[model samples]
Target: MELDFWQQRWHENQTGFHLSDVNPCLLKYWPLFGGEGLDENKPATVFVPLCGKSLDLIWLASQSYSVIGVECSEKAVDAFFSEQSLSVQKEKSENFNIYKSEQIKLFQGDFFQLSKHHLASVSAVYDRASLVALPEAMRRRYVKHLAAILPASVSILLVTLEYDQALMAGPPFSLSETEVEQLYGSDFEIELLCREDIIDEQARFKERGLRYMFERVFKISR
Candidate 1:
């Protein structure tokens, strides 16, 4: 998929992937990484790729972690700060429109254009919707860039979906367990944190002809 695909989605307000609340899996499994696991030299910062006005940013800051989010949609970035009732400080960089409020900063631009320098203080990642949003080819490219930019010892909390692909097309694609390992195993230590059948909870997927679907959460340490 291209950048315009998502920009259009936001423009048209076709955002079924956008969640209204902080994800339950995050609340349950985050403490497994523990507070001390982050780098002690400075405040811990979590890099949220393709972040789309997620309430998770606010939740992370409440727990004392600084947030660095990279999003392609200016609409999404603006909506996040507005809905959160935050007063933002804006600046222009070579590749991004950087917006800041308190401990949260969002760089609005293409994810591929983001570099190591932008994530220098990042000690962890929270990927609730990013990985599963792409096709196989782009997903590979995404992982390669991520591995090259991020430092070792950074922990990633990733959530993905699994289902029969022939049943439906996707922006929220189906990713099996093996594919998740293959994508990140070369760059990080992988652990299956939890897996659960969540098809019943998702009424839209059921309406789309899915027989069953599962959600998987992984802890990937770089």
Candidate 2:
């Protein structure tokens, strides 16, 4: 998607895709990575890319890992801190403003513009709506940049939506399981953790005449 597309979305407040509550899937599956007994010895930072105003950042903070989030829209970044009732100090950079608190720091700029130095400490990534939010043309570049910056030890928890794209123009783009595997399989050990058909539970898409919706979870490690 063009930067203008997302900037306009933020300007018009057309962010219906942003979730108000922390994702349940994040809470449920996160522990499998490092919350309890699993890999607590891993690094202490988690990277959240294209992270809009999701409460998942707060959940990450509660888990005791510092979170670094990158977003293009300043409004969305501001909303995250305001909605959480946290006071943040802003540091200006050439490409972005770094809004920081005790546990979370957000960079306001193009994700691709971010340097490896800023991301050197991050150990993993949590991508909920980020990948699908991009248009098909941008997904490859997005994945490539992510792969280039993240350390070899990093892990990824990604969620994606699948559906018949012929029926709808989407920001919540449909990506089949095979497509996801093709995108990241070369670099990481790709594992499919779960796939669920949530067509009946998806009221928004159903209203738009979409007949099917699939939710997929993927784990990627280098």
lDDT of 1 by residue, 1-222 (tens): 988999999999999999899999889877765554433433388899999999999998998889999999999999999999999999999999999999999999999888889999888899999999998879989998998888766888999999989998897999999999899998898889888999999999999999899999998886
TM-score on alpha carbons, each prediction:
0.96, 0.96
Report every candidate's CA lDDT: 0.89, 0.87
Q: Which 10 residues in a row give candidate 2 its minimum summed lDDT?
A: 34-43
- Residue 18 error for model 1, in Å? 0.8
Question: Which candidate should be chosen as best, given lDDT against the real structure?
Answer: 1
Candidate 1 clashes between residue pairs 3 or more apart in a chain or in different chains: 153-222
- Candidate 2: tens digits of C-alpha lDDT, residues 59-165: 89998899999988888998889989999999998988999999999999889988888989898889998899988888888888889888878889899999989
